[model samples]
Target: MTDSTAPRGGKRERLVTSAGERLHRKGVAATTLADIAQAADVPVGNVYYYFKTKDDLVRAVLEAQVDQVEAMLASFETLPQPVDRLKALVRRWDEMRDVIARYGCPFGTLASELDRRDDGLDLEAAGPIRRILEWAEIQIRQLGQPDARELAITLFAGVQGGALLAGALRDPNLMSGQVRHLERWIDTVAASSTQS
Candidate 1:
């Protein structure tokens, strides 16, 4: 087991961080504890000390992703204008176009893969997406959209679609184009809100 007194950000942190990255790049089924152990530079046997089972580690990864989603949404809350905040969200993805082109959106890809399974873990993996939808809905509602929930789904769907195409086609431009379109769409929504 990991030492309880181990310094902060020790082996356990490394394992979780490495596993998250590997699990994103490699599908959950394809990622073995051995792979994570090697990536984290922890001994294969020691992996079991920290994570009793693969499922345990997977849950940890899901929790980390959820935390990241919460942080991203909280950061947007700091912006003064709802439209600008939404634009910044789009721009964040645009900035990651190269990475998305290579690996797709980390959360999107993982959720898509896990969603195909009948196992209950899929629901756990999807928590981050659900949180994101809720956050987006709040942002859209702030723009005075009556169908905020539906619009939020559409907005995120566009982003996910862009990531899928960008990864499949190995084209960052596709992601960038989607980001630009989203920015324009946000502007249109904001303008419509003011006129009504």
Candidate 2:
């Protein structure tokens, strides 16, 4: 007999997608396998068929988020100048403001949660967030800064802080300010690199 409870896209993919959405909305600690199962319209047994446990499901969600960032970086990678690539990245964020504003940045939330509770889940969640910072560093390095990595990390912190403030204030413009501040900071780095 066909497994009627099996998710349409297949168990693993559906579970990951559902888990990611729930994790984004309710956070990793707050999200339960049962919640994911309900979101995916599958049974708990089917969810278990894919993810052995909640941590396994969290890892899958983080992996998907990393894949998404990698896809985003692909387009930015080809830009001839690092500063131009940085600008393009900011522009892309402007386009994503609606979802980002509503969800409060999944990667940011994941990073915050990881800080609060360190575990295997932190390993999974922190990797993607680190990759984003690494990408920023790569762009910053193009400007020939002596401390590109440090600058990148600083910029990432600013963005995350801005996102938190925006979400707390419930103001989309506040969230966009984070992107704006980052862009301005990057421009200064680029200018200084050129003059030095």
Each model's lDDT: 0.87, 0.78
The prediction achieving the highest TM-score against the true structure is 1
Model 2 misplacement above 4 A = 1-8
Instruction: Give per-residue CA lDDT, model 2, range 1-196, as digits (tens).
Output: 5465444567677778888888888888788788999988888877667777777778778888898889988888888899888777666655666666677777888777866666667666687778878888888887888798898888777767776776677777876877887788878889889535
Most lDDT-accurate candidate: 1
Expressed as tens digits, the lDDT of each residue in 1-196 for candidate 1 is: 6577343558887888999999888878899888999999999998888888888888888888898988988898889988888888878889999999998998899888888877788788789889988888888899998988998898889999999999999999999999999999988888888435
Cα shift from native, residue 86, model 1 (Å)? 0.9
In model 1, what lDDT does residue 108 have? 94
Candidate 1: regions farther than 4 A off: 1-9, 194-196
Candidate RMSDs in order: 2.5, 3.7
TM-score of 1: 0.93
